[model samples]
Target: MSAWLRRGTAATYAATLGVLLLGAPAAAAAPSAPAPTGAAAARKAAAPPASVDARLFLYNEHGQAAVAPGDTVTFVMSTAGYPENVPQHKTVVLELPEGVTFRSATNQHASGPCVPDAAGRKVTCTTQDPVDQLPATNGAWWVTTDFSDELPLGEYVTAKATLTTEIPDPEQDNNVSSWDVFVATTGDMSVAISAPPGPWKVGDKFDATFKVHNFGPYRAPFSLSSGINPVSGLRYSGWPEGCGFDPGEMQCTFGVLEAGKTFEFTMRFEVTEYDADGISLTPTIYPGNQDTNAANDKASYRAKIIKPSASPSPSPTGGQAGGEPTLPITGAPAVPLAAAGLSLLAAGAGALLLARRRRTS
Candidate 1:
């Protein structure tokens, strides 16, 4: 009777422990959260749309952000940001502004040339082969556009470029790029150097005058640089406040010169004893803007160095009035000539004295 009671009590305790262990987990477990809705749901869904990427950009061949009217400018459509994920073919659609016309598009990596539509307003660059690698995959195209002859100066022109690939882009913001260029005007810029008068000897200091003139229908705001090439024996001093000097070059800047306007400054330079025959100053002007006449953009001024003449020997003044004629003594010392003349006189007197003694005897 005792064994049966002990076994029954033990079995009841084990059953209660098992029930507590199973019930505790369910009571401590956290509740389930609600699903995302509306914009949040949309954003989550769009987060991992695609693995590939496409980006577009437009820039000139020179990498400058401006363009000139009546000029055929070469532009680059760069899709270098496209990824090398799946072997996907890429395409670029270039939309030009109204006054700009597409001339041609070429890609060194493409199997064929980029083609333009009938109106020449749009150009498409696509490679038939899949672009899965860099360089070998033609990642860029060179496009040419001819601006209308009448594009107004200082106006802003915008060109847009769109890049697409076989794979979808997760981010649409980088798929298109636009470039804004200012319609630059033409300015004829020329430089003139007025060096101080010749007879410029060593150790002489003088002013070298420089004049930069813009003979234009428009002002020159960009690409304007003027400078003087330094001569070996020339020393620069009293430099113009606007000019800068490196070791062997002088750089000058004149900001925003208008048509028929000129900027003048003088620099003082001294000649050193170093053997420099003549000084030639070639001041070059590169307006960087469209120059109508380039012939006069560079001017050269050459100044000759005159050497001091050797003075002629002073010939004895032609027989000064009532004065003895004096000959220019040449060779050795006057003492030797005087001694020879005395010896000759002594011999003649001795010969006369001996003859007189013989007559007396």
Candidate 2:
């Protein structure tokens, strides 16, 4: 063979051997699986964790009592844990009602002067110490907090607060579970009258004072008037100050009375005739926008007056000298048999005497 042909044959054989060796290894090795997508990984990470739910309880220490405007009120918070292995530690926050100011907090878990938020809006009250170890079944803790004198006098003012627990998991912290509590304020009123001494004589002029008080949550408007039972001998002479009156109609208007406030007015009456019977003074209260007749029907108080006794009248002649000892007899007419028999006997004797004298003549 020629040298060039031998060199070509040798080079071709070497190239063929190199291709076989590279292809055999590539075929033996398999392609690795693609990495999982971010979404799939996240889903796996988000798989629900094994956890226990926590619980809490809240109550009003004031017995859900009512409070008037400008009155400070306190509420009590009670908390507890549920389930065996759950240790609970939580933070609490409260949103006070309008017209109320924060006063003080007791049984605080943490220390430092706590106050309302910068806007003077929300209260930033929180528990200082952690609820270390909770009872297996049920355990509890409580605290009382007071509000400042900022309440407006009114009905149905609401006070509210919330309790929350932070749940811890390996993946995340501060998972919160919460509950809420609420309470309201109180309202009441008292009414009375101041008047002249009794045993009122005929034609005597007198005046009476009526006082109204607000003992409850807010202020209320009222109407005042007087009534007389003709039989009671009690009559109203002039309507109360600032009041308009007709013979049988009395009407007066009183504005609002703030909680813990009072108002008074005067009324006049003249005793026209002597009243042997007793009398009664009735004073009533009416809410705003109510009719006078309807208001009088809601009388809050009724007082009575008794007239002094009068001298006794003399007995008639031929009757009992004194009022006592006089007995009343009631029956049919009666005849006396003995008196009739005596009259008949006398008439017969007179006839006999006249006949005897005639015979003698």
Candidate 3:
């Protein structure tokens, strides 16, 4: 083709692209989000040039390249996102749902810090140390995450991964990857809670902290129940769901607890009376899809309430007011026998005369 004809075709193609990507989507979703502008239009038109691309792929453990519930996933990522002469950096961030767990980096492609958020739902793995940037030919780096056994089968949980760069990726769609995880069953679960150790006071609120431990090879749903001891008078003041209080009992049901993992919670209870110093209730796991051990599954949680004491009164010789006083006995000479006898006789006659006077009066 002639040089003039080729140049005219190129001009037409660029105009069409500018209208397609930079103009159309922005016109629809952008107006509802941000006000329309010519500068914004120009900026959007400039970012993706049809060159940059990053590929993030997910694979199951069995090498089938598919994800199944209760199985670990191998993530392979590489970069064609930058030019050969220039080094491309990727700080990958992934937010996993509740059922999926982040494993370790067996052969980490790039070296950086892997940190999880407080909820453990999101993790950021970056290459910050001696080795950084994606090597040539999409030098694939691999990381892993797993779905727990307790995860509900036939449910989909979204997994989002992002790659960060100084310049916008031309193929930004590949910079982020989205996939759904399908959960499957593994085995039975065993859950146990340590009884609260306490000699709590009566009529006062106290936390009945329980240490719930999962003792199983596979992750499983954690649900527990116990009838309120009628004699213990243990009542809930502040309760959370997964926990229920009926007229005679209270029960707790947790979504899932990972294998060899422990969870803790403080259930508020007020001591009504000291009738049962050692409060005990039979705790049992709410029967689920898989429950193996019934013996250890049903355990007792025992706590002691402080016994009441009665106030004591002061002793007679305790020096308290209104108490009987001690008698003093000083020495005195004994009276003569005749004088003693005459005195006794006079005293009797005087007593009789006084009695007669009282009767006459």
Best by lDDT: 1
**Clash pairs for candidate 1:** none
RMSD of each: 17.8, 23.7, 18.1
Off by over 4 Å in 3: 1-188, 195-201, 230-232, 276-278, 287-289, 310-361
Per-residue lDDT of candidate 1, residues 1-361 (tens digit): 9999999999999988887888967565757688878744554455433667667777877654356777887878766543442455678888988889998665465423578889898988775642334443556788889999788785667888988876777877888988766677766778778875766777888887778887777766433233333356777776665567665566665446777888777778777744445766667776746778889878776666555567799864667567878677589898998999999999999999999999999
Q: Among all windows of ten consecutive residues in candidate 2, which has the lowest summed lDDT?
A: 172-181
Q: For candidate 2, lDDT tens digit of each residue in 140-249?
A: 32333444455433344454555555553332222222222222233455567767656566656678777777664545555666555444355665444657655544
lDDT of 2: 0.51
What are the Cα lDDT values of the candidates? 0.70, 0.51, 0.60
Q: Candidate 2 deviates by what RMSD?
A: 23.7
Which model is ahead, 1 or 2, in terms of TM-score? 1
Q: How much does candidate 3 score in TM-score?
A: 0.33
Candidate 2 — which residues are off by over 4 angstroms?
1-50, 108-115, 119-121, 125-130, 133-150, 168-361
Q: Model 3's lDDT to the true fold? A: 0.60
